[model samples]
Target: MDSDTFVYTTYIRTTPEELWKALTDPGLTRRYWGVAFETDWSPGAPMVWEEGGRRTADPGQVVLAAEPGRLLSYTWHTFTPAWADAVGLGHEVYEGLAAEPRSRVDFAIEPSGDTVRLTVTHGGLAPDGTIKELIGEGWPAIVSSLKSLLETGEELPEPPR
Candidate 1:
């Protein structure tokens, strides 16, 4: 609700159930998000982030809320050395991000005239926060890729090296 919060919305030509699946299903998520989560979708359950054959999660990263096909909220990820190495981020920068207060992301899904509106609100971001900026930079591409994958049955081309 504040400037520290980042909200992204995209309308996918799909059902709310499908959009929810894309947000919660590990396999589906990995296809578009480049990351998969391990969680039971319970409010208090832990959400582990796995990607590129590396897994990283911490106590601070857990499901804040879950309602299938309607809403899902979870604490943001933990930055680890393996994650930094895999993502090409410097370890020091990773540490700096890790030191910041953990943020949370909430996904709200709604039916909208043959399409589903998916809104992602990422909050707890401090002004000029490193992790905030990182997530803000990342969400647009992530959301667009998700839309493409759901609509076209295929993901967009990989970024150039």
Candidate 2:
């Protein structure tokens, strides 16, 4: 209920290890989310984001936590002009995003009987900010696609940009 944070939870018919792989594997993430992260996934390891054929890297974009099959957290990528252009964001919108403080996202995976419970928490956002508003619409679709891919071996259709 915090305006500065966004949280989404879903149950998937899969094991925690498998779910963790799907979240961390570049191939799996690209298939479901069109974003592939290049990182060792260890705590404090730097991460490079690949999306739409563009790579975004920064020293601050490092993994905050990496407990395989249990928890994963990282600071969000820096908003660059190239990335904004690749994603079709307008100049003004991009400027607004660049001005906001960077956010972090955490994924908690827990075993639940025959399924795993996946909870994604994105925090450090400004209340009712542009990035917050954008992710408010993005996380659900991304999580749903992730669920469908693990359950059916196929992801949902590409979402509109």
Off by over 4 Å in 2: none
Best by lDDT: 2
Residue 109 of model 1 has an lDDT of 94
For residues 1-161, write the lDDT of model 2, one tens digit per residue: 44888999999999999999999999999999999999999999999999988999999899999999999999999999998888889999999999999999999999999999999999999886899988998999999999999999999999666
Candidate 1: where are CA atoms >4 Å away? Answer: none
Q: What clash count goes with each model?
A: 0, 0
lDDT of 1 at 45: 98
